[model samples]
Target: MNLNQLKLFYLAVKHQSLSHAAQELNITQPAVTKGIQRLQEYYEVPLVHKSGKNMELTRAGDNLFKIAKKIFELDKLADDCMAEFHNKGLKHIKMNASESFGAYYLPEFINRFNLKAPKVQVTLEVLSNRQVVENSINLKNDIGFVSFPVKDRKLNSIEIIKDEIVIILNPFHSLAKKKYLKASDLEGQMIIMHEQGSYFQKMIHDLLEANNVCVTMPITFSNNEAIKKAVEGGTGIAPISKKVAAKEIESGKLVALSLLSTPLYRTFYMIYHREKHISGPLKQFINLIQQ
Candidate 1:
């Protein structure tokens, strides 16, 4: 049977009603039934069984239905792959970035890139910073915008801009109104922290060593949003990037302070594989970042 018949069989199993499936396909019920019949004949299996105005798949039919669903999805997958293949020559760029970059930077940056290379198709993938790094050097993604430096030898990095990590505290906390505080001043303070291994975590690790002060971990979280929420609830304090605190600071949900002795700061870096050839779209994007 043809792909159309296969599609009908898949839809029939999904909806469990031949008439409903036919309605969705905008074809007659008999046409849909005929398609399923043709499919079962070709595949030598009954892919659906009806009872009490509803339908269910027999054991063998259930497996066949699952396979049929994947087959249809594969066709769509092929379409996307082919589109990428053709579009690459016409200046297509695929990028994977952290949520902050995708949410804050991509809209205007992509608009500018499109103006520079009108024919390019720019696809942006929003993921965690770690995922961006993984996709980048693994070659699944064309370019990666990461918040920290990566140590991979195959990865090339360009320092984009440095974002200061500010010491944040609850508004009513003793240190909240301070103009500046030193690293030693934070001792014994309830400092909430994100989990380890991230660049920000590494920065904190270095900061403590540089200041020769170590504060006990007050609370820990796995995500930036959770850390911010804990801080907002007056659970504890945290040192975080300016970009992460901008909205909260503006809305008066938190207070930002600088360290007098050990000022916290982190740099954002644009990274890509050194050996990977830059596509025209990615080249334009890199130029846009430089500008």
Candidate 2:
């Protein structure tokens, strides 16, 4: 059961010479013999016999040698894998983020990171703000981005960006020409809402309620893309991050109207578990994004 003795026996069987095995092991020939002797004693079998200046393995020794070959090969493979990781030859990063950051912001950072570390594989999942925080706290991901600050002892967060919530309307909508709009401007208008209970939905809801603005909520979508599409199709006006609709605004497919009475903004934060190990590739990615 002693690994050292098994190794000695394996090496002796491999070279068919105790002297050669000892030379490779950097030990005395007598030491190699004693090691093999201990193995044979423990197994209660004659593993090897001298035959005309060469060593031959018995049937039991042949079977043990096969298993030893596999064991040593696996050990070597494990060493090689660890060495590659230490050298940063192969790396993977898993991340979770809210839809706004994941869909609109993080792609640029990921592209830049890939240019720097082409070998590192990156995976990103889009979830709600609460889901991002929960995943980060549970160590389900290496990093996370959320729309709001997270206050958890198990997590470390940094405010990465501040995003403004803007009203997105169809370019042909009557209010699209207005430079800005007041809460009353949206009264009785069909409002495209995010999924119920979402942070974004709550933010828009609170803003409207605070100003006593009553708008008809006719449609709800779980993701920004769907909401934007609905707005472009003239389904209703939607309140969303300006950055999320930047392309549509630039293309004149959608017009963004600022809130004249109460401006709304949300902070995006990069979060990770305090106990998570920041590997070389992961640190590089964090630096690239933060920069």
Candidate 3:
């Protein structure tokens, strides 16, 4: 009828006597008899023969005992599996990030996380700033990284890191020699940019307008790699976060210029849905980037 009763049925069938089963199972003989009676009543069958001192099983009891043995074995296996699932730790983590950090920053951090949790599986998605916001709102990813401010009041966002947006130019460009260029000094120079709706795009547009500097119509690209390539071709100059251009700037291909009279810094955020429950794996990942 129930697991406890089934267990009693199994023990009674094993020992072949209610008194002996009661001794082995730490229950009274009446309790064992009651359990067997309940099971017999539920199935409407006789489970024992009254021919001997040690009872022998009926045909129905043989089949029922076999199943009870299997259930007990399965209970043991279930315990083992749960123990391993907990002891071995989380199996996987799904993470998302915007352009700047996704390409440059996340790989090394994820590698280090794998080292710490070797058994855990991990999938990383590189998304735009908009995608990060939308994914977090929709609870599509366990964690998301974004550069700009997110207005979703229903999400939890942590500004884990911050860095400045620097002017980028090719090595052969005239302005490449300057360590810093003020907004006023940028007048009339060709400038490629990330498309509108990007955090840096809005910031640069506002900064140039406030300082009364305007560049000629120039190429614009939606993503960073294309914009970087366009700048490297001497078509125009664009500003980007220094973290994203570390490799190119280290090499001789491109140069980074600081902005004068401007504090053009963007904060890298770790955002997730507030309603989504934080599992140990997600918490571990947040801890990894937070440090």
TM-score of candidate 1 versus the correct structure, residues matched by position: 0.64
The C-alpha TM-scores of every prediction are: 0.64, 0.69, 0.68
Q: CA lDDT of each candidate?
A: 0.79, 0.87, 0.81
> lDDT by residue for model 3 over 91-177, one digit each (tens)?
666788987788877888899888988877888899788887887775667788888777787589888888888989999998889
Ranking by lDDT: 2, 3, 1
- Please give me the total number of clashing residue pairs in predicted model 1: 0
lDDT score for residue 268 of model 3: 84
Kindly give the number of clashing pairs for every candidate. 0, 0, 1
* lDDT score for residue 34 of model 2: 98
Model 2 is weakest, by summed lDDT over 10 consecutive residues, at 76-85
Error of 3 at 50 (Å): 74
lDDT of 3: 0.81
Candidate 2 has a TM-score of 0.69
